[model samples]
Structures are given as structure tokens and as C-alpha cells.
Target: MQSFFKTNWIHSLWLILLFAGSLVGETVTPKDRLIVETLIRLNRFDVSGNEKWKGAVQRYARSQRGEEGYFELVEQFSVEAELPELLRLVEEDPTSALSAKSVQLIFRLGEQKKLSRLLSGSPKKKANAIITLIGFVKTPEAQKLLDEHKALSAPATSVAKGAPALISTADDIKALAARTGNVKQGKVVFQKFCFACHKAGDLGLDFGPGLSEIGSKLPKSELLLAIVKPNAGISFDYEGWTVETKQGSFLAGIVSESDEELTVRMVGGVSQKVKKADIAKRTKMKASLMPEGLHLAMSEMELVDLVEFLSSLRTR
Candidate 1:
């Protein structure tokens, strides 16, 4: 019968769509490529273990064009590397915006005294440094010094916390799923936190992976997990990689297109065309370029809302 043939054709079409979806189980998006490129640059610094890059970074920080990238480098290296020289470079020009942030970072780590000592020769030279120290120091000693010197202003010190550790269990994630989330509020949360790097519905930069159709690709639980712990799962072809050159320099970035010549996209959105003849060593990185604790900035309910918004993005 004609009705039976139409029903069979509809079933066949459904099967075809199911098969097509399976083929793209772990496909990469443009945002993934961007994050991989950023990871590449971070990994390059990890692999080389070179001190010379410090000077290069300092110079870049001082430069108007590359200062943003310089700060990102400093933040990543703050825990692993001793960067007294880089600190000195910024401190010497204390009034600059970058220097103020550097001073705040030093004080946060209880190392403002090191900055104070660097300015120690003359009382006149130390006045500006003292003012910075007094503004950022929380201790009684700083107040005593400020009182003794009769310093002009005493701004409140800033307290910073380290990134929150991931503590969500399977039960915790399941509980969150059961809770209701407001999609409209979730959109606001995404704008506040993820809009800068991630793309959704023609909004946001292309710098990170596009989440336009992420809901259909990943389950709600996996989506929640990815937001809290980004390094947990990385898409294929978006892994971090480092290339050591014969000239003793290192290149970091995601390999975009590889063949006779490998194309790597580096941090700050720079593309590197690498030739096989120039390569000394190539290593695949273990850690992901996508930093973790993305959900730390949001409240639990806000995160649930964000997850809800993402989950609603299923393709028809």
C-alpha cells in the first residue's frame, strides 16, 4: 500500500539522520581550534624551560602591541617560575597600569617587601614605592610606616583567592540536573563569563569553540562537567602541541593543517607555517589549553542556568 511505503520512507530518513549524527561524534569546532592555539603557546614555554623567554616576555610586556599577551604569560608562569626580573621591569615603572597590577600580585603573595627593598637607596626614591606598599599592605606594620611617614592616602588592600578546586561528584552533578534553570538568566551568565571566548547564536568572539549545536552533541551531565572542568575533555585535533626547532627555539600552538608543511596557530591569534626541515622535535601535550574552573566565577544556580541554556541548543 502507498501508506506503508510512506511510513517506511520516514523510518529510513530517521535512521539516516541517526547515522549522520554518529559520524560526527567528536568533531571539532572553530572555538576548539582557538583554545588549542592558546594551549600551544602556553605549552611552548613549558617545553623549552628557557630563561631567555623571560627577557623576551618582559620586552613584550613593555611594548604597547604585545602587553596583553605578556600579562597572560605572567599569570600562567606565576606559580611555576621565579620571575623577579620581570617583576623588577614592571616595578621600575610603578605608575603604569601594568605595574600597579604587578604590585598587587606581589603583595597578594606576601612579597611586597621584595619590591620595597628594590626601591631602598634614597628616601625620595622610596616615597612612590612606599605609597604603593602602604596602599596594598594589610598588616599593622604597613599602617605604622604610613603613620610615621604621614603618607597622603591609604586605599583599601585587595584580597585575591586562588582558583577554586573541582569538588563536584557524580551525585552532585545529578542533583544539579534535577534542579530547574532559567534559560534567560543562563544567557546573562554566559555573557558575563563565557562571551569573550565562546560563540553562541552569532554572539561572542570566534576565539574559543562554538557551542551553537553543543546540546545535541553532549548530554546535559557532560555539559555541566565541561563547564566546571574544561581540561577534563578536549576534542580531537584540538590537543596542545610543542615543536622544537633546530635553531634551539620552541614553537607552541595547535596544528591546524598538516602536510608537507604544518600550519600551527599560536596565542594572540598568530598563525605559524612550519616546515618539516626546521623541526627538531615534536611532542603532544598532556594538559589541555582550555583552563579549568570556568564555572568558579558563577554561583551554583547560575551555572545550572548556563548549562540549561546550552542544553536547549539542540539541532532540529
Candidate 2:
């Protein structure tokens, strides 16, 4: 819905960033959100991911901690992107409330060497940091690191919460533009995520389009779009239909209609037959049978790997 199209999204961010060095204004306008979003657009920052983009953001935020939209920006970035700023927060100001998260992220990144280095030196506000790190990083070295300061810290605490990963289709497009995938890895990713619904070669169900030779039929960009935003362009015979029955049941899938009956074909090739007289309502769905936002389940790098695998499925 926003005006996001351009020659290059990252380059567009750089153009604005250059101006922001002197012109970094308040978070009053949409520009602040746009800048942060662009910085993290390529890679979703998780413990398992991201690059230096985290350091740049952390360094910039230190001065703006009390600013209007600070928390909103922190909520955006994730991944390897975090080790430095977070690790620094842990090592330098361990007593700071931020140190708890800093230690957690540092552990998630598995920067064992860096965590050990931080542990080797003692900081004043380290009790919470030590506790959080010990709870998360359970290596022998980490245990030793905690043992060295056992008396100074409290018992390690643990809390488990599931947070859904965030990644948009636009983000994947930009990230994949600069990266390549391993076909082998991509195939593994495909089996983990896509094999159930779409068929490729002799593998998978044929509930959706057969992708045995999709590489020959569609370009790379089109393939990515199909996966990330299947609702964007519904292919022929793949449009979904919703049929509400007199029995108060709702069935959605590809539909075959006859004078007296309706056949609804769903994922996994399951089909339901309904008498036309029993149908209370029949409507066409706007989106494809293929689900939207599937990209959320995969990391950006894994997606790149998947596209690489899909692209390789061409005619001989």
C-alpha cells in the first residue's frame, strides 16, 4: 500500500542515510520508520542471523535512547547484526537493564569467544548479565565463566516464550538480489517447508501447480513472488472457491461445479462433494489456494536457497 517501488530499495536507503548524518530529524515523520525498516529490510535479525547492521543501529541508538520513537526502532532489527552493540552493553555497563538482553543476544549468536572475553574482564553491573548469559549459554566454558563469578551473581533464571519471526516479501526480494543459494541446502529447505503442497519431480503432492519444471516455465523473480506472495497473482485453475453448505460447513479450495453437485478440491488432493441444493453460498476467493505469508516460516538465507533449488528444476 505504501510507495515502496524503486530501482533499488537499499540504495534508496543510502540516499536518505547520507542526508540524515546532518539531517537526522525527530521520529515525527514517516522517514524515521522508513530508515529503520530499510536498514533491516534485507535480513530479519534473529539470534541465528543478521550482520553489522546491528552495530550501526545500536551505536546510533545510544545517543537517542530518550528520543520519541526509539523503542519502535529497537523492535525492528534482529540477527548476527547484534553481537557488538549488545556484547558491548554487556561488557561495559553490565548493570544496565539493557545488559540482560545484550547478554541474551550475545549468547544466541554463540559468540562464545567474545562472551568468554567479556567474562574474563569484570564489570560492576554484571550480576544480571551473568545470570542471563548462564541461563542461555550452557557450554562448559560458559559454566566456568559463571563459576569464576558465582558468588557475585544470583541463580540463573529461565523463561520460554515463542515469538513469531518477522520477514516481508519485499525484504526477501532485496536480500536475495545480493545473495546466492546452495542448491543442496535449498532442497533440504524445500522438503522442510514446501514439499507437502507443491509437486516437483516425482516428489510431493499435486494439490497445487506441479513445479517439476517450473524453472523452465517461470523466471527467478516470478518464482520468488509465487512463494512469498501467492495471492499477488492467482494462476488459472488455481483460484480458490469457498462453498458454504446448508449444514453450516465452509469448504475452500479449487471447485468443479455441475448442474446438481459441487466438487471442492483442497490441499493434499482431498476433495469434497456437495449437492448443489445443500449449498447455502458459493463465492470465489480473492487469493490463491497457495497460502500467503509462507515466507514468515523461513529465514531469508533459506529462502534464497529455496529459490535456487526451484530454479534448478528445469527441462533437460
Candidate 3:
């Protein structure tokens, strides 16, 4: 009787384990729903001309939109119903967040003619839009417009005091045309000053984003800003900080870490590692470790060359 009872209990436990495994298998999480729902909604919109699915798109865009998915939708949709509305919104209220998003969409669509018309109509909106779009499209037409605007008016100095001074000239046009960066010289400068924080190809520190294609993604002015005033909140990322510990061991640098280790690249080009365990606490310093006078460190022509070098680094 005792032996039979033990066998039955063991069988019951096995059944419970099986049931738990099945339950785990049957339950669907957000990750599972995200791909299927996103794809299904994308396909549904692609097949039908209905704007009904736009709510889903907006939700996705607002919540957790992937770059691939966003660009895919942009590529697939030709109707462009939202764009006209966005453009109208911008015209009515240029400073609206909706207008800014609309301008971004226009640039993403690569509708240069429409963008040009919008710019012609509204100078302030055009200035902001142009600055944003310069990161994406570096076409000759865009360059010409930027040149024309700069010629007519001074480039706005950022509110940040002592912003890196930009010298705008017709010569800028020539530099833009030549696309000249002494890569050999740039490689040396990059290694000496930039490599401690930034990484390119297989070399340099990975504390900063890879610069293999930075030249292609950013304009000369923006790149210069990144070097000089790195803490201007340009994007969701790249804000530099320094951290201090209660133990009186303060580290001034950007925090680059992974699951295993926390790495800090100090302001004066020293890289240090603190074990994840030893860190009692950390605080963020407001300024960027990217030196303020880096532009001054290089000659004007060299700076232009470096800009030329960085501008040419495009992946696509």
C-alpha cells in the first residue's frame, strides 16, 4: 500500500510539472505580440488604402517603434495622406511639435521640392528643419540652400555661451565640393584626441558611437558642435557625464558599461574600470568630457579637412 501511494504521488508531481511547462508555452508575452501585431498591422495597411490602421502605427511610433519597422512603413506607403496634414499643421503653427515631426517626415520622404517650398514660405521653420535634415540628406540642393541662407544671414549662435565659432564663407562651398579630408592626417588626430572616447572600424574606445559613418550622417556645423559643446542635448544619446563616489574617488568621464564591468574614460584621456561590485553610488556631471577647445587645437583648414573627412563617412 505504501509503495503504491508513493508511485501515485510521483506520477502526480510529474503531471504538475508537465502542466506548468504547458502553461509557460501557452502564455504569450509582449515580445511575442509585438512582432506579430506590428507586422500584421503593417501588412493590413499595405493591402488596404484604409487610414484606420494609422492608430496602430501611431501607437507603435510612440511606444516602441523599431527603426527597421518605421523605415519599412515609410518605404511601403505611397499614399502620403499624413504628410499633407503635417505640412499644413506646420504652416499654421511652425513651432508645434507636430510641425517638427512633419518636417522630419518630409526629409525622410526625400521630397526636396516640397521641403524647399515649405522653407521658402517659413524661414524659422526652415532653419530648424534644415538643421535637422542636414543629418540625413547632404545632397547638393540642400547644401546650396544652406549656403544661400548662410550668405544672407549669420548662422545662429546657440544659446550655450562660448559655442564653437563657425566661419561661414563662399570657401565653405568649395570645401563642400572638394570633400577633402586628409584621411592620413585625420587618422592621426583621431587617434591622439578622439580615440580615447570614440571608436572607428576596429580601433579606438567604444565609449562613444562609432564614427565610421559619422561623416555621412552629420553636417560640418553639427559635427563641430558635437566636438565643442557635447552637452547641448542634441539627441536622445551622446550626452556625456562625470561621476563621483562617496569614497572621495571621483571620476570625471563618460560612463560606458556592460553587464560585467563599468568603464569610464576620464577627461584627460585615461580609461579606467571599476568592478560592478565596488561602486557604492554615482552622480552625473553636467559637462561633456569632449574638450571645449578641440576646434582651436586644430588649424582652421585642418578643422575643415576633418569636417570633410567626417562628412564623407556614409554607410548607405
Give the Cα lDDT of each candidate: 0.57, 0.60, 0.52
- Model 1: pairs clashing at backbone N, Cα or C within 3 Å: 31-208, 31-209, 32-209, 40-252, 40-253
lDDT of 1 by residue, 1-316 (tens): 9999999999899777656643664332333334435555666534236544443343333332234454454543342233474466455654334453454345433465565555443345335543543443323444444554443333322212442335468877777777778999998777655654456886553435689898898888888888766777887766777777787645555776566677755432334466788888888878664545556645677877888898887787
Better candidate by lDDT, 2 or 3: 2
* Comparing 2 and 3 on TM-score, the stronger one: 2
lDDT of 3 by residue, 1-316 (tens): 9999999999899777656744665333344346437666665445244444453344343332223344234434422544565467557654333343344455435564676666656666445534443322223444665566556556531233432245345465445435556766766556544654566666564555679889777777677667655666434455555444445444444567889667765322234566667676766645553545555445655665666666666787
- TM-score for each model: 0.46, 0.46, 0.38
lDDT of 1 at 70: 49
Clashing residue pairs, backbone N/CA/C < 3 A, model 2: 45-78, 45-79, 46-78, 46-79, 49-79, 49-80, 50-81, 94-125, 95-125
lDDT, model 1 = 0.57
* Highest-lDDT candidate: 2
Residue 252 in model 2: shift from native, Å? 1.1
Q: Give the Cα-based TM-score of candidate 2 against the true structure.
A: 0.46
